[model samples]
Target: MRYSLAIMAIALGIGGAQAQVSPPLQVQEIGSFHVGGRVVALGDMPKREIIPSPGAPPIQMDPNGEFQVEQMYAQYIKLAEPRARYPLLLWHGGGLTGVTWETTPDGRPGWQIYFLRQGHDVYVSDAMERGRSGWARFPEIFASEPVFRSIGEGWDLFRVGPQSGWNPKAAQRRAFADTRFPLAAWDAFARQSVPRWTTTDSQIQAAYNEYVQKVCPCVIIVHSQGGNFAFNAALAAPDKVRAVIAIEPSGTPSAGTDASPLRGVPHLVVWGDHFADSPFWQKIRNNVERWAGAIRDMGGTADIMDLPADGLRGNSHMMMMDTNSDEVAGRIQAWMARRGLMR
Candidate 1:
């Protein structure tokens, strides 16, 4: 069930206000469910009614369960004839939304618009819980189980075994225990709810087949954990995807697995140099490069981009949201242009 980027944009253009600088984004709850249940709404607010950010338009959601903001900016319509442009699917990292790809902290136009200006149709979204998209549904499922709850409580639980604790750790007694169960539950909920989160490698391939047959074959741009999902998806439909660009992707799904997906697709792996400072940086990078090499070895194009060792600071995970994000965006543009993906 694929929809054209143009149709999505128009549908999303209906109610949201413009963007603002300070709050940048505003999420309003138009409706709610039971206590401790989820709330259906316009923006990214948790409880309480959300206020619109100054200069930003109010967000809107349609009765069909489609989030308009994601459609409007992330999924773009071609300005010229549809045949003349390429389609691109952009996925952000964990805890972020499609808006993060389109707007900076100051609320000005961001990367999605940059790609739009370059003449490519794009679709972006908050993987699941980060943005105006459904938040409660996921939490409810994760909150149902204790093991899953622990997995969801901290970051990197999925990558490093759960024993790593909330901060970071080495191998543990059990991969499930090291991670917060709540977090795992959340991830499971996301996979079950999001159309893109296919449970098995074969399902991902099926999704690609459907996308290619229904929509224009697209270039997949994934950041962080999305890199994992996109890779698996591409592995499933190598013939349908044009290319893959991953930004600071997390390392998982060991390269040695016989089911190692992404065996024969053009791929670009971008990593923030700050990751070098982490104690586990070497192991993580090795895993990432090994996977990249595997893709290339299987006849897929693969490359890696390491951010300036000192240019972008803070946590390595924060590189995407850093003040110098434009630099990253520019590099992405260059990469796309080099691949002839940009129109």
Candidate 2:
């Protein structure tokens, strides 16, 4: 289905967010696609009744479970521009949906439009079991209950502010004074949260694999947990992946995995600030550096970008949502151009 620039902006908007930006857009085509998931026999639900008044007649709702299995949910937005060398596929991190690439909480345009206006055919997706994708029953289809994230954890884990003196009033109390993330949009950011499950990781991986196959020979831009997945995806099918750009990925493949798989595809890993305050991230950063070294040793192209060291500071895990997001995108675009990946 093709969507006009204005229509897409409206569809993705919440109450106050600005419309998507698509200027100088030479988009020849814009559409969506889905991959993964299987059909299943849906079970029936218990009946329920509603009464308008006490001791009055009641109305009942006995919904029938639609029979037949369905595919796993992973939605994709495809925007094609003749200027791009190849397609650009985006993958989101854990606990988030495709909205990660959508408008920022501050009502600003997202990377999706940023790249589109830059002349690349971009595909943004809702990973398996994410938004618009269907969910299964617990224990029956899903092996475990879905896990959730709290705003407090986000404030700390995302490095939006100091861990101490954190509360629902985080926006007013202690947001990093210099953080690019719009403090006023704290509530909007929280709305992007999604249920995450450890037990379904394999399924998620499979779904991602299917997605990669469907959109191969493309550059991948992934963030947080998506970082590792993008690497593995390239490793799993190097021919399908032209390059990979990981933004603060949460994990990586074991050292035992062959780095040669990705030797042909260029790799770029980027990190934001706040590692000094988060030990967990410090370890991850160290490991990523080491991994990059190992890949380089194997005659692979593995580059690193420490945003803070690069003179861009006060960024959080959600750096793309930071105030300097377009600047960052420009940096990546420059790199891609140097590599002859895009116009």
Candidate 3:
């Protein structure tokens, strides 16, 4: 029960009206840490030539800068006065930043605030090489060029609807029809998508390991591509990670990988709807099922949540950005309490 008048008031979205919630968080701290090798030399790189005026021609500069910089960047916002036994750390999927946990595409609150209000110190991170964590030049630092996500890809992959066309309006229509994602905020969500480099996974995973080591005995909530990193983080430092909530993780520990480290640690694997209809997603579901079984065999408490099975249906791949996101967060909060992680 502490207050900070300068920063306490925040508007809460309930029933379409504004209600100010004072001190949504007791303490908020923001910072960053660099990782991996640094490039000491300034070098030439390609850029779009912009002509200033009719008489002034396009300018091409070579070896323009002279400063050392690192490729991996790790930024975080730590909220204090937590009611949970350990801090809750949120890791976003590929091509996204910590914004994934702060606001939905449709302009709703994200899980970061949800958990904070529930009395848990929270740490929302922008993983290395994404968002605030930066990237080095392709062919220089990265093995390949970064790949960008398109609206069609997002719609198909995120289970928003059958492949929408490339046009923004068409995608918007599809998103509206999907009824899972906040259609009005579809463009906003799309704006957050960024390029990602698969070649940098090792560096990214290493940074994740360091982050977990630096802040341990904490609960990790991971989404999409973040699932594997979070899973491995728990495995790498079993004594440090108390619980894991993998939301539709992209991959998992192989059946042969030893999950014994997770013994007595609560783990939850949550799945959204529309997977059975998609052959591609079905395989993913099958893989995670086996992985969960493997962890159980190794003496860990692993529970699975198939949203449709629980009567919550029509959820897209981006469940955190779905219309009923708060409902989903509520379920997760209850799960934490049931596991005794909540105070």
Candidate 4:
């Protein structure tokens, strides 16, 4: 699927240093739906006057009513001709939506389109309280306030650069010499960060479990916080989860949890570079590694793809958005093929 420039130019009947263009995607059907939510009923609450928009008149709002909350939203693309045996489900990390798999911060097509072009029907989702999935009231339905991520916090936490290297000016900002992330799009990436709740993990897991039940006998590709949900979802419904590809997963189940459920499942954990530079990421990696080890102990297929070790270095935590994202994706595609998940 790697298109050389000469071949592309010949195919398009053009020549001489032109930018490469992707072929049109062949899709059978495209649709979306909202899944996994419960209704919350309230009573005896006071009505309040609130403005619905800027320069708008205030209206009386009813506080006591039945409300739907904690639901997850999902959109899917089914290819005209699929090469994979089952559909692929993509789950995003914390503070992000299905947008994580759709487009890169630099405006490049992301893994959603990449995998579809690879001939897999793909389902991209917005976890509960994210994106089009909508959010619940804080301290009431959500039980906690939403927490937002700062740009500098992401720069440091995502291993894009050292904390000291971050500057308000992109020109003044310093990044790891070998970093693959698109530094110029750092601010645009920050716009993708949403306000995440600390206490919503259980609700998120529940919704993910329901989602698996709804759209699977499938493989799932998860990143960061979505890793925990994907792992637990497989444990909850082993028959439905064909395989798991976790790219820089931020968390995992406790190492002691019985992983026998995954004995028949294949798992791949992909890591980018610069783990040694962040103690926080180092701890996260160890925790996920221990969980993978536990799965191996249970006779499951749990493999690690350390990009640096594979000589695919300079990837940030957001490898899917990195410059060489397609290369990283090709690696995952190969792993899936080796696992016999691909046709």
Give the top-scoring candidate (lDDT). Answer: 4
In the range 1-343, model 2's lDDT, one tens digit per residue, is 2346556666677335333333445556666666777755554667888786999899885544553222444434444434668888878898998788888888788898787777777888776766766566676677889989887778878887788836787445587767767777888898999887777766777777888898778899999888777888888899999889999988888877778877888989888887788898898888787778777888999888888899998888987888888888888888888888975
The better-scoring model by TM-score among 3 and 4 is: 4
- Model 3 is weakest, by summed lDDT over 10 consecutive residues, at 6-15
TM-score of 3: 0.83
Question: What are the per-residue Cα lDDT tens digits for candidate 3 across 1-343?
Answer: 3344424333223322334344545666777665554555655665566676789978764544654433445555565556789888899998888889987776677887788788887787777777776666667657799889885577778777666433467433544343477766766788898888878777777788878878778999999899989888899998999999999998887668888888867899898887855798898878878888888998889899888899898888889989888899899999999999987
Cα lDDT of candidate 3 equals 0.78
The per-residue C-alpha lDDT of model 4 at residue 103 equals 86
Work out the TM-score per prediction.
Answer: 0.55, 0.84, 0.83, 0.94
**Over 4 Å off, model 2:** 1-24, 41-80, 170-172
Which one wins on TM-score? 4
Q: Candidate 2, 2: how far from true, in Å?
A: 20
The better candidate by TM-score, 1 or 2, is 2
Q: What order do candidates take by TM-score, descending?
A: 4, 2, 3, 1
Worst 10 residues of 1 by lDDT: 28-37
